[model samples]
Target: MIKHIVMWKLLDAAQAPRFKAELDSCKGLVPGMREFEVGIRTEGMEANHDVVLNSTFDDAAALEAYVVHPHHKKVSAYLGTLRESRAVLDYST
Candidate 1:
């Protein structure tokens, strides 16, 4: 299995609700995505990201399929306009 994680720094923390709605839209874009979850950070943790996503895929190829999927690309392009910075990670167990 592959665990894909993403941390997003939005233009404003207040914008997190909007971003979460958009993030949920990504679930239908990739057939291999086993699960998807998004979180908004409101605790004022100094080092916390504004938004985070957890996604699981069956394997590397399935995850790769999500990366190149057209719908995913479309959502990513929209995300660009709302983000200040982003980080990502993927690993298997």
Candidate 2:
């Protein structure tokens, strides 16, 4: 399986909830998705990013399919407008 993680710094901190909701909408978008979770920064932490996503896919191809799905593309494009920075990590487990 492949574990895919992403962190995002939003242009507006107040929009974190919206971003998390959008990320949640991506759950089950592809066949091999095993897990999907989104997290928002909590108070009292020195947070560099506003949102985080931790997900697992059966393989690299499944991850690719999720990336190219129309629903994902739409959310990604919208997020591009709302984010200041983004980071991603993927590894096989």
Candidate 3:
């Protein structure tokens, strides 16, 4: 399986929820998507990022399809406007 994890630091902290919602909207967008989860930072957490996504795919191809999906692209583009930084990790487990 392929695990794709991402974290984002938003330019506007208030937009964290909106960003998470946008990420959640991409769930189930393609086949072989095993799991998808989006989380927002807590009120008092010592965190650098505002949002995090933990997703699993059956393989690299499935992960690629999810990445290139139209809805994913739209959300990603919108997120680009809101995020100050992004970190991603893709690995097999």
On TM-score, the stronger of 1 and 2 is 2
RMSD (Cα, Å) of model 3: 0.7
What shift in Å separates residue 4 of candidate 2 from its native position after superposition? 0.6
Q: After superposition, how far is residue 80 of candidate 1 from its true place, in Å?
A: 1.2
For candidate 3, the per-residue lDDT at 64 reads 98
List candidate 1 stretches off by more than 4 Å. Answer: 44-47
Which digits, one per residue and each the tens of the lDDT, describe model 2 over residues 35-78? Answer: 99999999899888899999999999999999999999999999
Q: Write the per-residue lDDT of candidate 1 for residues 1-93, one digit (tens) a residue.
A: 999999999888788898888888888566678989998886756656798999999899989998898878887889879999999999996
Span of ten consecutive residues with least summed lDDT in model 1: 40-49
Count the clashes in each prediction.
0, 0, 0
All candidates: TM-score? 0.88, 0.97, 0.97
Candidate 3, TM-score vs. the true structure?
0.97
lDDT of each: 0.87, 0.96, 0.94
Model 3 lDDT at residue 32: 99
Error of 3 at 47 (Å): 1.0
